[model samples]
Target: MKRIIAKQEHCMGCGLCEVGCAVQHSKSKDPIKAYNHEYPKPISRIRLELNKPVSFAIQCRHCENAPCVVACLTGAMTRDEETGFVKHNPEKCMGCWTCIMVCPYGAIKADVSGKIVAKCDACTELSVPVCVASCPNGALECKEVTS
Candidate 1:
């Protein structure tokens, strides 16, 4: 499986990763519009974990046996066999937050206004995820791993 690995030692916690993710997922894909003009405000699938002296980025682990996939009551979450990525379908989601409760990493986030959830999709459409690409310090890396 291909996964994002975070090197906490190199992370500066500048939050550019969040900006990149929000812009990439925005309707206009514009950083300005994403932050200042978007009504709902695009959310970043990646989050930075910061402590006074340490920091790192985090997102969905895309578990080999994802609990979110199994706990989704409406079948909104599923793992793609070929890509080894966990996917979420908002249309099928009931907004019950079953998946949220089951996610061990607490990666899934609730979009209360939309009655949906959001998580990392690995930015599969692009060569690399915006979060990883935006890491100025090269703290985030994508690599293949055997599950």
Candidate 2:
């Protein structure tokens, strides 16, 4: 399956990925409006992790044995049979935070309203995620990882 890989050395900490993510998930499909409303207040699904030697965006791996999917009490998180992408269903989510606790990467985040968990879905509707599209530094790239 194809997944997003970050080139830490190229990251500029511009936070375009977060903005793109929020916009992609928002009803408005507008970055400015999405940030004002549906944006995850403090935490983002994809985050820029800074350290001495590295600073890069992190997101769901869509693991084969995804712990988040197994941890979800209401079956809110599921893996796509064809794409192997981890997808979340907001209506089924009970705001239990089980997925958040189980995700090893800490990629899962609560929605802006704190009503549901959110994570990368690879922008299944688009050829690539808005994050990759909006990244000015070429720091983020989505490519298929072959077995």
Candidate 3:
């Protein structure tokens, strides 16, 4: 399967990925409008670890044995067999936050206003996720992996 990988050596702590993610997820998909008009606002699915000597962006690992999947009672989190991407269905979500508690990577986030938990779905709707495209450095890349 192809997945997004982080090359920490190349990361310079630039936050363009966050901006790009917010804009892409925004209702208007516009930088200006997203910052000014979007209600409930958009958050970057990718989060950066700023610890000294090593800073890299992290997102959902989509684990083979996903604890989040097991923890979800509302059937909102499910993995797609064809694409190997774990996706969230907001409609089915009851916002119980059970998934958030079990995710070991701390990848899940609460979208209180949206009434759904958020995690990286790898931007399945796009050819390349906004975070990967907007990265100023080559720290982030999408490559095939053998698992």
**Highest-lDDT candidate:** 1
RMSD of 3: 1.2
Looking at model 1, the pairs that clash are none
Per-residue accuracy of model 3 over 32-104 as CA lDDT, tens digit each: 8987888778887778888877898888988887898888998899988877888899889999899989999
Best by TM-score: 1
Q: Specify the poorest-scoring 10-residue window by lDDT in model 1.
A: 106-115
Prediction-by-prediction clash tally: 0, 1, 0
Tell me each candidate's TM-score: 0.96, 0.88, 0.94
Sequence-dependent TM-score of model 3: 0.94
Rank by TM-score, highest first. 1, 3, 2
Minimal lDDT window, size 10, model 3: 110-119
Q: State how far residue 3 of model 3 sits from its true place (Å).
A: 0.4
Candidate 3, clashing residue pairs? Answer: none
lDDT of each: 0.90, 0.83, 0.85
Which regions of candidate 2 deviate over 4 angstroms? 37-43
